[model samples]
Each structure stands twice: as C-alpha cells, then as structure tokens.
Target: MSSSDIFLGETIGTAILILLGGGVCAAVTLKASKARNAGWLAITFGWGFAVLTAVYTSAPLSGAHLNPAVTLALAIKDNGIEWSDVPTYFGGQLLGAMIGAALVWIAYYGQFHAHLTDKEIVGGPGAQATKVKAVEAQEKGAGPVLGIFSTGPEIRVAWQNVATEVIGTIVLVLAVLTQGLNAAGDGLGILGGLVTALVVVGIGLSLGGPTGYAINPARDLGPRIVHALLPLPNKGGSDWGYAWVPVIGPLLGAAIAAGIYNVAFV
Candidate 1:
C-alpha cells in the first residue's frame, strides 16, 4: 500500500476502533445512560466488536495495524512494514484515537456532566463527591476523570501496573504475530481479525482488572491527551505521572513478543 493509503486507512480504522471502544466506556461509566452499570462483560465484548469492525474495514487499505505497538512488532518480525512507514501508522493511530475520544465526549456530554456531579461517583459506590473533594484537598491531583478516556491501576503499584500492561500486551502482540493468518502487511484477513478480536475479549475478561488492559500505546495516550485537554466540569487531572507506564510497557511487551517470534516462531 502507498503511504497515503497506510496513513488514511489507519486513521479511519483507529478512529472507529476508539469511537466504539471509548463509547462503550462512556455508556457504562456515565450516569443516566442506558448502559450504565452494565458491567465489564459488556465492555470486553464491545471492545472485541470494535476491533473486529475496525480491522476488517481497514485491512484492505492500510492493513489495519491500529496500535503502534502492533506496527513496531510487525516491523521487528520482518512483516514487510518498513521502518520508514512506521511514522505514518503512528501518526494516523494517534490522530484517530484523539478524534474518537473527542467524539465519545460529545456523544455522552450530558451523561458526563451528570456523572461528574453526582453525589457518589468518583471513588466508587457509596463514596460522595465531597469525599473526592477531601482527597483532592490532601492530594495534588484532581479526582481522576481520565478513567473514562484512559486506563489506570486499581491498586496504584507502579511495578505491578507496568507488569500487567507488559504481560497483557505481550499476549496481544504475540497473538497478532502468530495467530492472524492474513498475508497483508501486518493485517488480518476477515477470519483472522475475528479471531484476534476474540483474543482481545479474552484478555479483557482475564487480564483487564489490574491496569484496564491497555495493550496499545496509542489507545491509552491519545485518549489521555484528549482527556487532559477537553474542558468539562470537574474533569480532574490527567495523571501525566502515570502515563508513561502504559506507553513504555506496551512497547516493551511488543519488543519481547517480536524477539520471541524471531527466536521461536521463525
């Protein structure tokens, strides 16, 4: 595919991916939505379908590869995606992710307001906004609004969170490299995309609790940036301090997967 095709395809695909994926989060998290409190099963399945849709739609054009880590792993695996083309993929994915996240905010605008202002929302059940206020008084950061847009640790242990991301990403990239059967440039065929989507669901169900399973760098960072920038009432801090974990961990996992593929699969 041409550079333009790669860029546009990834941009469009990743946008759709994040639109549906982030949309699911909004539906489940935001108060007053029909899907409110729908729980984690819906989210995992929503993400799986999102991946299935995006991958098939973009495969013919840019070979999908919506995740930067996926692109890096494919390049490392000698999958015909050149180092020179990496920037195109990264640019498209990040741009698309931001757009998708913004769209999620727009779609759930009222719900977001309601959720943020609700008596008990931020610190989980039975915890009031006043409690969050006290925490914010003592803590330097605002109550985290980025959870709607990005991932975070349940326990706040840096090493554990990073390991969760790395291990999850390794599962994701290794599945893509080995299980996806399409011959296109790091892209899956229809069946392979479906299979890969199921793998994503499985990962979410099994491994998502710790760090919310941010197996893709762009999936976390792009939306996190949007979460930081978008103006909303009491949207809270973006937690820039913890942002590097998702990015670095996923890249490390991708590299490890690529090395393993080269050593064992090749």
Candidate 2:
C-alpha cells in the first residue's frame, strides 16, 4: 500500500477505535443518567473488541498502529520504515483521537451534565467522614454506594499505573511480533485481529486495575486532549498529572519488548 493509503487508514481506524473505546467510557461514567454504567467487564471486553475491529480494518494498509507507542516500537524493530513517516503516523493517530473524542462528547453531552451534580465532597479526614455520612443520609434506602466511581490509592497509584501500562504494552508488542512471524495460510490474515483482541484482554484482566490499561499513548493523550477541548460540563478530562505516564510508559515498554523479543525470540 502507498504511504497515503496507510496514513488515511490509520487515521480513520484510530478514530473509530477511540470513538468506540472512549465512547464506552463516556457512556458508563458520564452518562450515568442513561443508566449506562458499563461495569469493569464491559470496559475490558469493549476495548478488546475495539482493538480487534481496528486492527482488522487497518492492518492491511497501515499496520494498524493506531498508537504512537506502537509505531515507535515497529520503527525501532524494523529500522526499514522511513523516519519521515514517523511524524505522519503519530499525527494521524492524534488527529484521529481528537476527532473521535469530539464525537463522544457530542454523543454524551446530556449525560455529562447529569452526572456533574453527583460530586463527592472532600476535606480533612473528619470532614470526609462527615461528608460520607451526609451522602449516605441523602441516599438513604439506596443500596451501598452502587455505581459510584471513586479514585483511590489502590486504583490510582501513579507508580502502579505506570508499571501496569509498561508491562501491558510490552506484552502487547511481543504478542504482535510473535504472531507476525508464525502466522500461516489464512491464519496469517486473521493474526493481527486475534492478537489485538488477546493483548487487550490480557491487559484488561492483568493490568487494568491500576491504570485502566491505557497501553496506547495515542489512545490516552488524544482522548485527554479532546476531553479538555470539548465543553463537557464539570468533566475533568485532562488529568495532566497522569497523562505523561501513559505516553512515556508505553513507549518505554514497547522498546524494551522489541529488544527482548529480538534478542531472545527472533
């Protein structure tokens, strides 16, 4: 395929991915009014399926990178991809993410506003305890804290999140490279799709608890950028403090995976 076709495919494929993947997040979190809180399993499987779809659609033309970290890893491994194309791929991924995020925002505009009012109060420990009491009182007769999403140390530890992303990406790239080598006959045609689903499912099951398994740099950064740019009521979309980890962690993981795969497996 020509570079132009590859670029277009990557752009469109990534956009669809973010739209479906990120859209699911918005539906579950921001669209609580719609009773659309997709639980952990939903998120995990949704992303797995999204990856499968994206790879199947774009692998023929663009290698289905859809992530800057993946592109960087491939370039480092092959050394044949022109340096000039690196920027193009990254640009397409980011642009696609932004576009996909905008669509998500538009789709969930009403839900965003509805969930904004369900804020958790914060203060000193005593104040927090009191706030919890107040919330409980207000929510009397409602079953225990159902469907309320809260960020806590166990779930949001920075180091843990970064580590999980790194490991997840490493496993993802290793799987891709391995499948690329051994695929046979019609199986070769489906290898990309299968690997895409498997990697995401593995990450979701193994590493998702810490960082939500944002193993793709473009996947995290693009949606976050859109979250900031889009006017969603009370949506703190751009959590800048944690953003760099997803980008840097995945790149580091991919590089390490490539090196290890080459030295040990290849």
Q: Estimate each model's TM-score.
A: 0.93, 0.80
For this target, which candidate reaches the highest lDDT against the unseen true structure? 1
Candidate 1 has what TM-score?
A: 0.93
lDDT of each: 0.86, 0.66
Candidate 2 structure quality by residue, lDDT tens digits, 1-266:
56787678788888888877876666666536453765788777877887878778876667677877777766766443566778878888888877777777677666666655454421235467746754553333211121121111235567876777789889887776667422321111366677668778877888777767777888878776665565544343244656777788888898998788668865
lDDT of 1 by residue, 1-266 (tens): 89999899999999999999999988887778999889999999999999999999898888889999899898898655789999999999999999989999999989888887776655556776657664663263434456778888777899999999889989998898888857664677777798889999999999999989989999999999998889887677777878898999999999999899889988
Q: What is the alpha-carbon lDDT of model 2 when measured against the actual structure?
A: 0.66
Candidate achieving the largest TM-score? 1
Q: Give me the displacement of residue 199 in model 1, in angstroms.
A: 0.6
**Clashing residue pairs, backbone N/CA/C < 3 A, model 2:** none
Error of 1 at 180 (Å): 0.8
The per-residue C-alpha lDDT of model 1 at residue 170 equals 91
lDDT of 2 at 42: 76
